[model samples]
Each structure stands twice: as structure tokens, then as C-alpha cells.
Target chain A: MKSIFGKSKELEKNIEEYLDIVEEALLIFERDINRYLEGQYDLFEENLDDILTVENNADDILKEIKYKLYTYMLIPEARGDVLNIIESLDNEVDLCKKVLMQFSIEKPEIKDFIVSDFKELTKQSLKSAEQLVRGIRTYFEEISMVNEYVNKVHFYEHEADKLEERIKRKVFSTDHINDLCKKVHIRHFSEKLAYFSDLAEEISEILSVASIKRSI
Target chain B: MTSFLFISSGLFLGWSLGANDAANLFGTAVSTKMVKFSTAAVIISIFVTIGAVFGGTGTTETLGALGSVNALAGAFVVALAAGVTVYLMTCYELPVSTTQSIVGAIIGWNLFSGRPTQLDVLYKILGTWVFSPILSALFAIVFFKIAEYIVKNCRIHLFKIDMFTRIGLILVGAFGAYSLGANNIANVMGVFTKTSILASLQIGFITLSNTQVLFLLGGLAISVGVFTYSKRVMSTVGRNIFKISPVASLVVVLSSSVVLFIFASEGLESILLNLGLPTIPLVPVSGSQAVVGAVIGIGLAKGGRNVNYKLLGKIGLGWVLTPLFALIISYIVLFFMQNVFMQQVYF
Candidate 1:
């Protein structure tokens, strides 16, 4: 019996570590994007390395969590939903890594006027992912509080959407950069950053349904 | 040897009771894969045997009061009749209670032997048939409320809750099996008690009376039934009949087990009497009906949705039909045992 509870506590720790890695990657994404906008290439490259490491760690922990859950037969009733939530959260971390890698590769030259909008979009999108992590945590600990965090994810995702639109509208309308391809490239980055919020919103919806199914 | 041959029908009845009623104890746990079938079978066998040997007397005495069935051949026919009725009802997929069938069989024996059926005892047993389920439902409601409040207020992790619920299922399942053995053993071996020729056996510090020896045999027969035939019944009950969550399943098992314990435990009756409180009558009640009532209690707690009124009606119909079928079968079998088999069926 002690070993049974010991196994559960270990799995709980693994899950917490997995979520911590995801949240850490999102934070790195936010900081790196700001560094890129501010012309701090060295710091941006360093943070990119850090986020990649975090993303890899998240994957390893996720695999461990899945294996333990199946092998130990812990939470048989909610295992499927819990695995789905973790996999989706991993995707958000992957998105953060991909966004930073793209910024490094393409190097979209941004005008001063749209820099604030990009920074704001990065903040809002990461906020949605962060809120999603909280929602998943609440789903494990306190089911009733999960809905509150889910609503917050939705709220932040909506904010990110409005910012993405504003960035696109400004990029196309301004005469700051005359190259049409450059405008589209910057717009693409904006969409990629904003896509984190969309992913967060989707995960939050899954969490909502799973929590409802889990409610005794 | 003849005694063993005569007791075979009672053993058969014990087997049928175990096969059918074990599902009520651990059906959801095993069917949902929350607990393994092997573990459940082992635990149920051990606990049920212990309960039968230690705590089976109260309900057995109550059944004795209903009708003695003094001759071995007479007891054999009565038990065989009830067992057949239960088997047929189960084949037809109707809700049947072993307690009801056995009671009806005993009444049939009374009629055949020219002995007067004790009206007060008959009425008391009949009254428990109706009251036990209602009591189980009430217990379910109260326990469900307490469980819900704890879940909502505790803020425990989902994984931890799962762990606790798993452990709870096994522990509670043991109790349920014990109560089942204590309460329902009378239906299987109650008739044989009057005619059981087994002598008292000294085992270490304990001396088992002839009646306890009969109960031990009945309990083993029930264990055989659990091992041989209960898996399919558990699957049918866990997946098809209830469709409740694991936690709700735990609640149902606990509630029904408490009802069975209250009705079967002479110790509790004595305690209540000592306290000057109203004591519950010792009676053999239907484990199946207790489970159904608990499920309905959960449904009512959840605002009365999906209560399955049609199935309830069918069970109510079964309450009337099963005993009637058993009585007729008992009468016919007793006649054949006396005339065709040339056995003295009664005094």
C-alpha cells in the first residue's frame, strides 16, 4: 500500500514537472521574441537554445508520465483524458519552440510602430498558454476551479486574436516598409505567435469536457 | 452418505446464491477494471466464509421460525424448489431474490406437511422484503451526500482520489461480501439446519455447532459458485445494468452492504436494545434489490434523472411472481419426493 501511494506521488511529481517545463518554454518564447524585436540577437539566440532544451525535457517527462500511468494503472477512469491534456499541452510547447526557430531563420525586419503590437501579441498568446497550464493543474486538484482558468484562457486568446488583426492591418497599410513580401512575412510571424492562443483555447475546451466527465 | 446426498440440493442452492449475489458486491469494481476478478473472487470467498461461520445465526433463526422443514427429504425438496425457481427467473432475465424464493418454498413445505405456517413470522419476513430496499435507498442518499461534500470540499488531487477510490472498492467489497454471506446464507442452508446431522467439531479454540458446520458447507458452495459462474454475471451487471461511475458504484455497494449488515447482525440488534433504541429485525433480504435501490437513490440524488421506471416496474412484478413460482414448484417436488421416491418427506 505504501508503494502504491509512492508510485502515485512519483507520477504526480512527473506531471508537475512536465507542466513546469511547458510553462518555462512559453516564458522563454516571450522573452526571446522581445529580445529579437529589441535587436538583442545574442540574448535571443541564447533563449532559443534554452526553450529547445525545455521543450525536449517536456517531451521526455510526458513519455515517462504516460508509461507510468499505463503501467501502474493509476486513474484508470481519467487516464485517457489526462493523456490527451498532456499531449495537447506538449503541442503548445512545440509551438513556442517553432515560433522562436522561425524568428531566428527568417529574421523578419520590423518597423518601430509594429514592434509594440508584436510584443503585445507575444505577451497575450503566452498568457493564454500559461492560463491553460493553470486550468490543467486545477483539473487535477480542484475540478470546480478549472472552469475559471478555462475562461481566462479564452479571454486571453481573444485578446491575442485582436492584437494579431491589428498587427496585420498596420503592416499592410503603413508605408514604413515598401516590400509586399516583407509585409506578408511579418504577418506570418504574427499569425504564428497568435496561433499559441488558438492552441491554448482548443486545449482548454478539451479540459472543460474532461473535467465534466470526471465530476463524480 | 445419505445425509450428504440429501444435502446436495441445499448445496446447489448455495451455489446459485453465490453465483448470482457475488455480482452485487464486486460487479462494478471488476467490470470497470478497477479491481481484478481474481482478487475479488479470493476476497469474497474468504470474507463470506468467515461471515457465514461467525455471524449467520440471527437470520438463520428467523428463517427457522418461519418453517422448520424437519425431515431431510423435505428440506431437500424445499431448497431444490427455491434453487430451480431462482435459476429459471435468472434465465428469463428477471430480478429474483433467493430470500423470497426460499421463504415461499418453506411456506409450501408447511402446507404439504399439514403444519400451520407461522403468520407473524411470515408477515415479518414479507415486510422486510419491502423495507430492506427502501432502507438501502435511504442509506445511499445519506452516504452519497457525505461523499459528494467530501469530494467538493477536500481539494484532493484527481490521481489521489482515484487511488483512494480503488482501495475503497476493495475494502468495501469485502464488507459487502461478508454481509451478503451473513444475511443470505439462511436462504441456502436455513432449511438444512433443522435436519443437519453433522456433529460439533473442535477447531483450535473454537467449537463449531452442527448448524455452523452446515453454514460452512453452504459458504464453501457459495465460494464455488463465485469462482465458476460469477464473472459473466458481474460483467452483465457492471456494464449493462447500472452504468454508474466508479465512485457511485462504491456508494451503492456501501449502502447495500450496510442494509444487509443491519438486518443480519445480531450484535447490532443487541447493541441497539442495550441503548434502548428501536432494533432492526433480523431477516434475510434481497441483495439484488438493495443494489437496485441504491442505484435509484443515486439517481434521485442527481435530481431524479434516468431512474429507469420500466425496470423498477419489472422488479416490482418480480417481487410477486418469483415466490408464487417457487411455491408451486415446492409443492410439486415435495409430492414426488414422498410418493414416487418413497421417501418420508415430512413427519
Candidate 2:
């Protein structure tokens, strides 16, 4: 019995650590994107390395959590739901890493007019991801609070969507840039940044359904 | 040897009780994989034996008051009749309980031997049959509310809740098994208590009475049944009968176990009497019906959805039909045992 409880505590600690890493990855993504906007290429590259390291750590902890949940048969009733939540939450971390890596590789030319808009869009998108992590944490520890976090995720996701649309409008309509390719490239990056919030919204839907099923 | 042969029918009844009724205690636990079957089986066998030896006398005395089947042949026939009734009902896919069947068979013996059936005792037994399930339901509702409140307020981690629920299931399953042995052993061995020919034996710091020896034998038979046949029944009960959550299953098991314990416990009765409270009679009640009642209680607690009225009707019908069938079977079997087999079926 003590061993079983010990295994559960270990798994719980691993899950908490994994969530922290995912949250850290999103913070790094937002910071590095701001650095890229400011023309600090060296610091952006350094933070990119930091996010990659965090994402890898999150993946490792996720794998460990899954192994323990399945082999030890913890939470038999909610095992599938918990795994689904964890796997989907991992996708958010992956999206953060993907967005940062794309910015590093493409080095898209950001015109002066839409720079503030890009930074705000990244902040809003990361806010949604941050709320999603909180929602998932509430799902584990305090189920009643999960819906509150889910609603916050949806709110931030909506804010990100608005900012994405504003950035796209500014990029296409402004007379600053002459190259059509540059216009399209800015549009692609804006959509990529906003897509993080969309993914957070999708995961919130899953978390809501799982929480309802879990209620005693 | 003849005594063992005569008591075999009672042993058979005990076996069938174990096979069918152990599921009520551990079905959801095993089916949900919250508690392993091997652990449940071991705990059930040991605690059930302990309960039958120590706590079985109250309900057995109640059965004796209803009608004492004084002859070994008569007791054998009475137990055989109840067992056969249960089998036939199961074959027909009808709900049956050994408690009702044994009660009806003893009443049949009363008629056959030209003895007056004690109307007050019969009424008390009948009243308990009608009351036990309802009481179980009330207990379930209260316990469910308490459990829900704790889960909502405690904010325990899901993994920790899972671990605690697993431990709770095993502990509650043990209690249910003990209550089953205490309450329902009367149905298995009550008829034979009057005619038991077993000699008392001394076992290290304990003296076994003849009745306790009979109960121990009955308890062993029940254990054998649990080991051999209860697994499939637990699966059917856990998966098919109701699709309740593990926490709800815990409440159901706990409620029904409490019902059985109250009905079988003489100590509780004395305490109640001393406190000037109306005492619950020591009568054998159906554990399965109590579980069903508890399930219904949960349904009612959850806004009265998906209650399965048709199943409830069938259970009500079984309450009337099981005992009636047992009485007829007992009457006919006693005739053959006395006339054709040339045995003294009654004296």
C-alpha cells in the first residue's frame, strides 16, 4: 500500500514538473519573439535554445507519466481521460517550440508599423496557452476550478484571434512594404502566432468534457 | 457419516449462496479493477468464516423460532428444497434469494408436521423482507451525499483519490463479506441447526459449540463457492446490471453491508433495547436486493434518471414468488423423504 501511494506521489510530481516545463516553454516563446521583433538576433537564438531544452524536458516527463499511469494502473477510472489531457497539453508545448523554431529559421522581415501588433499577438496567444496549463492543472487537483480556467483560455484565445486579424490587415493594407512576398510572409507568421491560441481553445473543449465525466 | 450426508444439503445451500451473493459485496470493486479478485476472494473467505462462526447465531435463532425441523431427514429436505427453488428460479432467469426460500421451506415443514406457524415471527420476518431494501436505499442516499460532499470539498489529487478509493473498496468489501456471513448464513445452515449431530471440539484457546461447528462448515462451503464460481457473476453484476461510477459503487456496498449487519447483530439489538429504542429483528435479508435498493437510491439522488423500473418490478415479483415456490417444493420433498425413502422426516 505504501509503495502504491509512493508511485502515485512520484507520478503526481512528474506531472506537475511537466506542466511547469510547458508553461516555461510558452514564456520563452513570447520572450524570444519580442527579442526577434527588437532585432536582438543573438538573444532570440539563446532563448530558442532554452525553449528547445524545456520542450525536451517536458517530453521526457510526459513519457515517464504515461509509463507510470499505464504500468502501475493509477486512476483506472479516469486513466484514458487523464492521458488524453496530458497528450493534448504536450501538443501546446510542441506548438510553442515549432513557432519559435519557425521564427528563427525564416527570420521574417517585420515592418516598423506592425511590430507592436506582432508582440501583442504573441502575448495574447501565450496567455491562452498559459490558461490552458492552469486549466489542466485544475483538472488534476481541483476539478471544480477547471471550468473557470477553461473559460479564461477561451477569452484569451478570442483576444489572440482579434490581434491576428489586426496584424494581417496592417501587413496587407499599409504602404510601407513593396514586395508581395514580404506581405504574404508577414501574414503567415501572424497566423502561426495566433494558431497557438486556437490550439489552446481546442484543448479547453476536451478538458471541459473530461471534467464533466470525472465528477462524482 | 450419516450426519455429514444429511448436512450436505445445507452445505450445498451455503455453496450456492456464496456463488451468487459474494458478487453483491465485491462486484463493482472487481469489475472496475479497483480491487483485484484474488485479494477480494481471500479477504471474503476469511472474514465470512469469522462472521459465520461468531455472529450467525442471532439470525439462526430467528429461523429456529419460525419452525424447528427436528429430524435430520427433515432438515435435509428443507435445505434441499430451498436450494432447488433458487436453482430453478435462476434457470428461469428470475430473481431469487436464499433468505426467502429458507423461510418459506420452514413454514412448509410447519404445515407438514401439523404444527402451528408462529404468526408474529412470520410477520416479523416478512416485515423485515419488505423493510430491508428500503432502509438500504435511504442509507445509500445519505452516504452518497456525504461522499460527494467530501470529494467536492477535499480537493485531493485525482491519483490520491484513486489510491484511497482502492483501499476503501477492499476494506468495505471485507466488511460486506463479514455481514453476508453473519446475516445470510441463517439461510444456508439455519434448518440444520436443530438437527446438527456434530460434536464440539477444542481448538487452541477456543471452544467450538455444535452450532458454531455447523456454521464453520457452512462458512467453508461458502468459501469454496466464492473461489469456484463468483467471478463470472461479479463481472455480470459490475458491468451489466448498472453502469455506476466507482465511488457510487462504494456507497452501494457500504449501505447494503450496514443493512445486513444491523439485521444479524444481536449486540446491536441489545444496545437498542437498553436505550429504549425499537430493535431491528435478527432476520436474514437478501444482500442482492439491498444492493439493488442502494443503486436505486443513487439514481434517486442523481435526479431520478435511468432507474430501471422494469428491473425493480421483477425484484418485487421475486419477493413473492421465490418463497412460494420453495414452500411447495419443500412440501413435496418431505412427503417422499418420509414415505418413499422410509426416513423419519419429522418427529
Candidate 3:
């Protein structure tokens, strides 16, 4: 009598709210990246407060989601898997906040040659999140299409991996920048960007396994 | 024995049947609140009667071999003794088998009367009691696999699947209830089959025997038990134990029915006999035990981590104790009835 899908709608809404803030945070990151590349240093500094505000809001929503998940006994069969999904997505959102905060604290120099690659990396990372959100929505609304959206997330993560390798190689190969700390910073930022895609892939894997468990 | 009030003894067994065993048929539906208690009672009462009148005769023949209290006084005492034994044991948190109690009482009667209990028939009936749960577990495992395959290979929407499963559980539960009535009417109606006091009813063109009329009475008593006492059990322990999916619930119902029907069905045996195969023996098995086995089977298929062997161990102990208590009680009761009350239990 206690249904498996009873709390899914509430869970969907919470995840949606979390992802929305993450999306807003990503938009701010894009703006900051553009300002850095366009040589507008003061403007990027001014926009840091807005990204921080949205990240805080996302953190609040994530906290509420965890509280609800832990306290409320929803569907026993789905409770574990749903918690796993929330944890994975929560980690990614925290990473988004951390990356923007890093840019505000330690402003790294962006070379013009890799501006296109930075844009591409950001796009690929967001694409992974995009596919993951869609997949999660599918998991709640019409679970049959969950695999399709999950596959898309995997596809985007693969593309992000390639971009990460190219950006990292280009950062180290540059002759003008001989500072190891600067090179490592550039590579580390790219890795942080790639980490989003990794989380998305993990989400996809978790969803697939959860789906199988539900069927059984 | 000549008074109609004496039939109340058998009715008590019927009520006990409803109290303990009716949950097996409609527990999932009622516990889920999918079907109203009144609706379930009405449906089960109606179907139990129909199943008893039409299909209950086969199993009574087997139970008759186990006991056969031809005297009205003896039949009344046997049923009452079994009912009392079941009630007292249940109160002590022990699992009691009505079939075992009746068999034990009949054995008591046989020993008192100095008549031989046909060893071959008794052995066959005893064998069913041992094998019923095993067969039910095997059936459950097979059915669970089949249900899993259907869910996997089918392209049906999840909502549609949920809808289908709900309806399927109700229908199968009803069917299970019907078979339970048919098979178990033997335990309630067997002693009364050869009762000599009751008169047959004739309605113009149709005629009903005294035994048939007794079965109908027994069925009504069971329905009364379901409406009054069974609901309490359904709302408590039954609800907790039955919190499984539609597929697992269906597996439990279907497998329980299969074992009950197989053990009690003479028609299936005749068919096998005609085909020059080993005929399946007619025996009355415990529905409660069969349901337990079905639950265990699904548990095993799900990796056997959840099966409560300690509880099962307790139940096994009760199974051993049920008949021993009933046998001693019936023998003592029969002795008192014949001596103090000056009643003829045999001859």
C-alpha cells in the first residue's frame, strides 16, 4: 500500500530548484570567464557577489532536500537510490560554487590562445549537467526514457574529457608561461571543470542501477 | 445430538477457520485498503459456500479417512475439541493447525473405539502435511521468476503495470479464497459428513443431503469468523507480514492455492490414474503453512537474507505440539462425554 513513487514528485521539485541555482551560478561563471578573457578585471570582480548569492541559495535548497530525505520515510525500495542521486548532484553543485569562489580569491591569468578552449570546456561541462537534469526528470515523470537521457549525459561527459585533455596539454606546452604554479593552476581549473562531467557520468550510472533495482 | 444447537460446535471450527485462514485469501487486498472489509467478507462468504458445495466433497473424503466420527455426538465433540485446542494454542502465541487437531482427535476416537486407522491412507495424508510447504515454496520460486520475466520483457508503462497488478492481485486473491474454502471445508465438514441426526432438504425438483447442508452451515460459520475475528488479525500482524509487491503477493496467493488444490483434488488424481500415471493422493494440508512457505520462497529468491528462520523454528515447534495437545484433549473430552454425560461416542 505504501507506494514507491509517493515522494518522487517532492524530490523532483527539490532537485529542480537545486539545479536551477546551479544553472544561474554557471551563467555567472560564463560572464566572469568572458570578462577575464576580454581584459575587464574590475567588472569580473563586481559580478563575484552575485554568483556567491546564487550558490548560497543552492546550498540552502540542498540542505532542505537532505533533511527531507533523511527524516521522511518515503518509499523504502527507492529511498536509498534517491539519496544517492541527491548526494551526487549536491557534490557537483558544491564544486560549481567552489570553482567560482576560486576565481574570485585567486584570479588566474587567461591566455587568448586558450579562451576558445575555456568556452568550449564550460559549454561541455554545462551540457553534462543539462543531460543529467533531463535524465533525472525522466526518472520521475516517465522512467522508461531514463536510459536515453542518461546516455546523453555519458556522451557529454566523454566530450568534456577530450576538452580537458586538450586544455591541460596546451597549458603545459605554452613557452611564454614558465611558472609551474601558474601552469598547475590552469590545469587544476580545467580538472575542476572536468569534475562536473565526471559527476554527471556517475549520476547516469547510479540512475541505471536504481532503475534495475526498482524493476526487481 | 439430535438438536440443531449441537451443529454450533462445527460452526465454531468454521469460525476459527475464518479467523486464522481467511487472511491468506484477502489479506493483501484488505491490508492495502484496496478492498473494503465488508466487501471482502461478502465476496469470500459467498464464494466459500459455492466452493464448498461444489468442490468441497473431494477433500472431505480424504479427511473422512483420517477421522470419520459417524455418531452426531462424536462429530460435535471432535470439532469442538479441535476448535478449543486451536484457540488455546493461538492465545499462547503458538501456530496451530486445525487439520492437525482434527486428525489428532480422530486418531483419539480410533484408539478409544478400538478400530484401526488405515495406515496407508493416514501415511499419505501425513505425507501431504510434510510436503505441502515444500511444494508451495517451489511453486513460488517458479512463479516469481515468471513474474520478473514479464516485467522485464514487456514494454508496458509503469502506471499501467501498477494498475494491472492491483486488479490481478484482487482477482487471484478471490480465486485463492475460493480454493481455500473448497479444500478446507474438509477439515470443518469431514466429521459431520456421516452425522446421522440431521434430515436432508428437498425443494421440489432438487434435493440436498444432510452432509451438504452441514457444509453450508460450516461455510457460514467461517464467514462469521472472517467478519468478526479475522479482521483483527488482518489489521495487525497480517498487515506487516503482507507488505510485499503485487508480484510477490500474487506469487504467495497462487502458490498457496496450487498446493491446497493439488493435495485435495480427486479429479486430478483420477485423470492421472486414467493416463496410467501415479495418481496424486487426496489429502488436506494446512493453508497457513502453505502461505508461510510461499513467503519463504520469495524470500529465498530475493537472496534468502530476509527469511526469519527463528520464527519459522517456533512455528515448526507449534506444528509438532498442535496435534499432541488436541489428541490428548479430545481423548479426555471423549472419555468425559461417554462416562459422565452418558453419551454414545461410538457404536
Candidate 4:
């Protein structure tokens, strides 16, 4: 964080701290979702509480960054772009908390046959987020590496999309689950998980646009 | 007291110069909130005074050569004519040039006195007026390109670039003010020096020349103008005109300063001549024209569609009318000063 924002120490510290909270929430979101896939529903519930707290913390930091930039006239030339990039980054944390809350309340039971596919979707979605983390970190510290990780995010997002489509077709075509309502629920949750990767991809594009106006 | 009254018209023009041209110095920096108004004011006042006291001679020599108004009454009328031209233009919200206005009034003085106008020297001053803006535009284009390349290719973060630019604006603005003072101070105080009416006085240990004392007073008048009236014009230019990026803003300002400094610097001209290059003329170039040219340069570089041709046409009209009006007023005032007052306006 310090390396990425070395010259402007105060703005560097604030934005770095905000990105840290967001990454924290996202890591917990990744871990909790995987734990649920492994049948540790009780432990997932405990992690869900931490994710919610971090999400709120991320929200507060976003507001704080905006206020500081306004009140102190920080980064007079690039303040608008900096605030916008952080806002987009913070949205990912909000999505994580929302997705975790849905899982906690729904508590959908997965059938044995499609367990491997569901886990595969989870891994791809988490990969998108992990690549997003690296892209953002690189955005601050080393712009040369930004395109590298942002490209990976796009690749993982495409993979997540293909997995989601397969899950949808299989669930609707086969009568393995037998209950129509349960089949729709499983399909809806799978699509939502795929949408997680879509969010990461959206953030990557946002970062790209902001960088165009920022330095280059 | 009589000497002060004799120099009052010059002081009036000095005040107007300070008010209007200070916008060129610190307008972008203050308007963008990169520097506070008070901070800009302090820096501008000190530097302009220093520039006037130390380096005000080069361009004054140009104006002095163009026409030597040897009588105090004649110099007084010329300053008043130019001052009135600037005042009228300011009311119409036109950025007028004191250099051009005073040049026109001197031409008017020559016409009324039946003296031969030095067409060759006049042509050189006129040529610079034409090229100042064009040169400024070229400088701006080159500077903008270099700045754009640096921002895009450098490994530095965006926020830090912005911070650095803010600091850069302050430093460049101070330089601009200094150059402005050195060049434009002649428009305010040049005519009065021909009379040698104000004798040198000792202030503490420093025995300043009459010309330097007159310049110091004129510089203060300009400073007073900057403090009291520049904000309104600065705000208007900052918000209403070209919505430029920080880099573009810096490019425009630095470009104008380069042109103004070139016109005022004999040292730079001799260097060019020593290198077997054509020398730059030491003329009183218009700061307003240079800034306008810079803005146009950035506009063209950004694709030219955003150029405000209507306002520019209006400003060009103002530039044309400024000299003509000053010439007519000075001719009229010189006739009355010579005939009714029975004053010897030309030696």
C-alpha cells in the first residue's frame, strides 16, 4: 500500500486502509462460501458475521475518503477520479456481504450429484475476486502489472459464465432433483455465484477507465 | 505633491495594469484552489515590485525610443489617454494591453506635434503584437505534448502528479508575475522618465534613482490593483473560459510567460544573435494576447472544436479598437495641452 502511494502519504494511507478492509471482507467471503460448500454450515455462519462487520467498515471508509477529499481539497486535479475508483472498489465488498447474507438465510441443501460443479463455480468466482485484489494493489503500487491481473480477472469471469450456463442447462434438462422449486433455487444460487465474477470483471473495467484519465 | 499629480495618470494606468494582468499571473492557481488568494497576492506583489525596481528598463527603452515625450504635460496627457483606453476596455470586460494602448498614444503624440513617426521601430513593436499570441500558442502546444507524454509514461501515481502540479503552478505564477512586472512596468512609468521631473531621494541607506522611485510607486499601484480588483476577473476567467486540465492550465501560463520573457530579455536576444540566429525584439508584448494564444493552442491540441470563436472575435475587436481609441484621445488631449495651456509638449 505504501509503495503504491509513496509520494502522497496521507491519501495513500487512507485509500490503502480502505482497500485493506475491502480485501479483508472479500477474503472472508471466499473462505465462508468454501466452508459452506464443504458442509461446515455452522462455521460459515460464524464467518458471515465478520464479513458483515467488514462490509460496514468498508462503507464508512468510502464516506471518510469522500469527506476528506472535499474538506481538505486533497488531490485537486485527480480527486474526482480517485473517489470514483474507490467507490467502484467498495461496491464489491457490499456485494460480498449481500451474497453471504443470502446463503445464511436460504441455507439451501445441495444434492450429492452436482456438489463438484457447485464447488468448481465457487473456485472460479473466488479466482475472479483474488485477481481483482491483485489488480487493485498493482494499480496503486505498480501500474505495469495492472493489465496482467485485470486480464486474468476477465478470463476467470468468462470461465465463471460458462460454468453457470452449464449448471442452468443440466438442472433444467434432468429430473435428478425431482422437486421443481428446489431446481429453480439451485439455479438461482448458481447464477448469483456467477454474478460475483461478473462484479469483479465490472470493477476491472472501471479501474481501466479511471486509469485512462488519471496518469496516462 | 505636484510631481505626484504629474505622475497620477501613470499611476492610474499602473493600477489598471495590476488589476487586469494579475489574472494572467495567478488566475489558474487561485481559481483552481491550488493556492489561496492571499498567498498568491503576497507572492505577486513582492515579485512584481522586485521585477519593476531591478529589471524594468529593457522594454521602457523600446517605448522611449518609439517617441520621446520630453514635456511633463505631454507625458501626462499620453498616460491619461492610455489609462482611459484601458479603463473603458475593462468596463466592457475586454482584456486590454497597456503596451499597445501606450504605443498608440505615443503615435498620437507624434501626429499632433508634426514629428516624424519612427515607422521602423513602430513596425517591430507591431510585429511582436501579431506574433506574441502565435508564439504563445506554439509554446503551449509543445509544452502540453511534453506534459502529456510525461504523465502517461511515468511510473508516478495520479494523485501525486496533481500535488506536484499544484506546487508547480505557484512557482510558475511567481515567475510570470516577475516577467509581467519587468515588461509592462514601462507602459505605466516610461513616459514620466523622459521629463526627469521626479528627483532621486534617499530612503534610509538606499539612494534610489528617480526612475526607480517612480517605478516603485507604479509597482505599488499595480499591487493595489491586484489586491482590490483582480479576483472578479480571475474568477470569471477561471470558471467561464476554457475548462482546461491542470496540465493544460500550466501549459497555457508557462507558454505566455515564455513569450513575454523573450520579448523583454535582451540577454536572450544577444545569445541568439551570437549563435548567428535572428534576435528576438525587445518589445512590450501584450500579456493578454499571449494568454489568449495559449488557450487557443490548447484548444486546437484538444481538437479545436471547443474554441469559443465568438468571444475571441469580440476580444480581437477590443484589441483593434484599443490603439485607435488611445491614438485619437491622445491627439485630442495633446492639442489642448499645447494650445490652451501653452505648454511645450515636444522638445
lDDT of candidate 1 at residue A3, scale 0 to 100:
83
DockQ rank, highest first? 1, 2, 4, 3
> What are the per-model C-alpha RMSD values against the true structure?
1.7, 2.0, 7.7, 4.1
lDDT of each residue in A67-143, candidate 1, tens digit only:
99999988877899999999988899888888788889888898899999989998998899999999999999999
Clash totals, every prediction: 0, 0, 0, 1
Cα misplacement distance, residue B111 of candidate 3 (Å): 2.5
- lDDT of candidates 1 onward, in order: 0.90, 0.90, 0.76, 0.82
Least well predicted 10-residue stretch by lDDT in candidate 3 chain A: A70-79
- Shift of residue B66 alpha carbon in model 4, Å: 0.9
The CAPRI class of candidate 1 is medium
Model 4, B124-218: lDDT tens digits are 88888888888998999889888876765775665677677887888888888888888888999999888987779798988889898888888
Arrange candidates, best lDDT first.
1, 2, 4, 3
Q: Write the per-residue lDDT of candidate 4 for residues A41-112, one digit (tens) a residue.
A: 889887667987887888887887888787667666567766777787777788888878888899776776
lDDT of 2: 0.90
Ranking by TM-score: 1, 2, 4, 3
> Positional deviation of B228 in candidate 2, in angstroms?
1.3
| Per-residue lDDT over B60-177 for candidate 1, one digit per residue giving the tens place of the 0 to 100 score | 9999998988999999999999999999888887777899899989989998898898899988988888888888889998888888888889999888888888999999999999
Give the residue spans of candidate 4 off by over 4 A.
Answer: A1-7, A49-72, A112-216, B90-95, B201-206, B269-278, B300-319, B336-347
Model 2: fraction of native contacts? 0.70
Worst lDDT window (10 residues) for model 2 chain B? B88-97
lDDT of 2 at B40: 85
Q: Which candidate number has the best DockQ? A: 1
Error of 2 at A63 (Å): 2.4
Say which prediction, candidate 2 or candidate 4, comes out ahead on TM-score: 2
